[model samples]
Target: MDLFTESGILLLPRDTFLTDTHVQLLQKQRIWEVEVQQVLSEGTTENITNQLMDLDADKETVAAYVKALDKTRSLFDGIGRDDKPGLEQFSDVFYEVAEQSMKQLGLFRSLYVLEGSDSYTYRHSLNVGILCSLIARLLKWGEERIAFMGLAGFLHDLGKMRISKEVLLKPGRLTEEEFDQMKQHTVYGYEMIKQMEGGSELLALCALHHHERLDGSGYPHQLKGDEVPVECQVLAIADMFDAICSDRVYKDRTSPFEAAQLLWKEACNGKLNIEFVSHFVRYIALLYVGARAVLNSGEEVEVILIHQDEPMRPLVRRSGEFVDLRHERTLNIEKMIG
Candidate 1:
């Protein structure tokens, strides 16, 4: 076992036999556990079992995710047919499930690689809602504001419900005309929420502007920075992130780590808010420090350490030797397997 300090200093090298003096040395360093053969910690090494669940459903983690997803779809279907679902009612149900999903599990654990395309939009909505709450908490927003952030995220893609199955579920890339038509959902959603009796104007605005990029490159209104509300900015990051982490009909999914890298790149290119992206990237990287992942090369690797400067490029251990992803240009983390 290799012993390290609480601050990650190498106090005792690997292969050293455990002795009374070594135990005292570890105690002095305030180290609780050693990195056994450089394997990741319990939180990540036991990742398969760490999946967040909706305890109200009394099901397994995957089952709970499916349950919440189906509930969201049913609600959207109500909206599609002009049922005019109640905003407070919807928020109540959403808060119940989103809150349950976060129980015991740390933030951002909702970044799962979904297998099918049938439930993408609604699942994306819930994922974004959950992620928004996390981002709000990270930003030190108050409880009520954080709840509003989550509700905004849940309703941000509500406009997509008006889109037809043919266009929304197209197997490949959308035609230019189809893409333009798809973009109308943002506007459609804004009007839908605006007509609701108890809906907040901020929530309606978030629904409309969630697709608006910071550089005025986004569609519809072509909004730019400061023109975009901080609430919508949080929704934008969460929306883009869930979309990337999920498997779309036109493209395969990227790992949360890789997706974070993509979000960081977009932020760097001035498409996203840099302040939010930087904080979120580091938060994501830190969560997976002891996690297991599959690389693009089809090799299984264990994340060992997160680089402070370049968080996306973490040090991973495969088989035994350590590989610094920052130095390896070709191999990239494809997705988490455990």
Candidate 2:
């Protein structure tokens, strides 16, 4: 059996699975590896299990991460634009390695987001992976398929490495010429993934077809509905979700509710799969449960669980008016108050 340590290391055990409690204890102590002789010399399985089960979830780790994400966003803003090519290449390598590590750990969680980014492409790629994994889990996809989608999501923009920095970061509207160049990253990413070892054609297909739309109006190829693979369809939705939500030279980062509203509208307009859009919307809204938030009235509160039918508006208890955000169109979630 394979055992995972708290430090993110894995070891092969002679026999038996570690109890959930032992996992908790290791998680609590942050002592990933103990020379079995040193830590467990004569401890019984029941003893270890009891200790770990008593440990609480790591609040300190989560708080540290909130601070780290703020730092990472600032770091991305400062990275030299001239190093776009190098950063993009390194981003691909990083995600590829992250993909392998994810498979080994059986974790399809948001480590890619934690990995952070020094470039726009890398940041967007990691967001895609996080968003895609969220969608996959909501759809009840098996673990391997989820990981494959996560990897595909992470490298969906691998072709951007070939595009020029000036075109990518241009503050003004892209001229027709610059716009054409920007679109080539999809094809560029496909070719790179195709050449990589152990690459899936499905993943490369996501690279090629993520830009294609249901109305036959998207770039690279104008393939309409049913012509595109399901994987491609899913990736396309994930790509659009990440792109619209992030900050750009011309656009500020969109609020998650605003992004969700847009996704809902796009689904209605036939730009996304209705089922995929519905489930993905539900998935993302759930992740922010317990997050501190601001209402349009400027009141502060923590979000409770979402109402099952009306996910766009979660049930939140604030310090002021007991307004139900779902019913009150005027009051909305202002932002995540980190």
Residue pairs with colliding backbones in model 2 are 25-52
Write down the lDDT of every candidate, Cα atoms only.
0.78, 0.62
Root-mean-square deviation per candidate:
20.0, 14.7
lDDT of 1 by residue, 225-281 (tens): 999888988888999988988777788888888999999989999989999998888
**Model 2, which residues run further than 4 Å from truth?**
1-118, 296-299
Off by over 4 Å in 1: 1-64, 106-111
**lDDT (Cα, tens digit) per residue for candidate 2, span 91-136:** 4444454444333321212221121112445556655765676577
User: Residue 53 error for model 1, in Å?
Assistant: 8.8
Evaluated against the true structure, the overall lDDT of model 2 is: 0.62
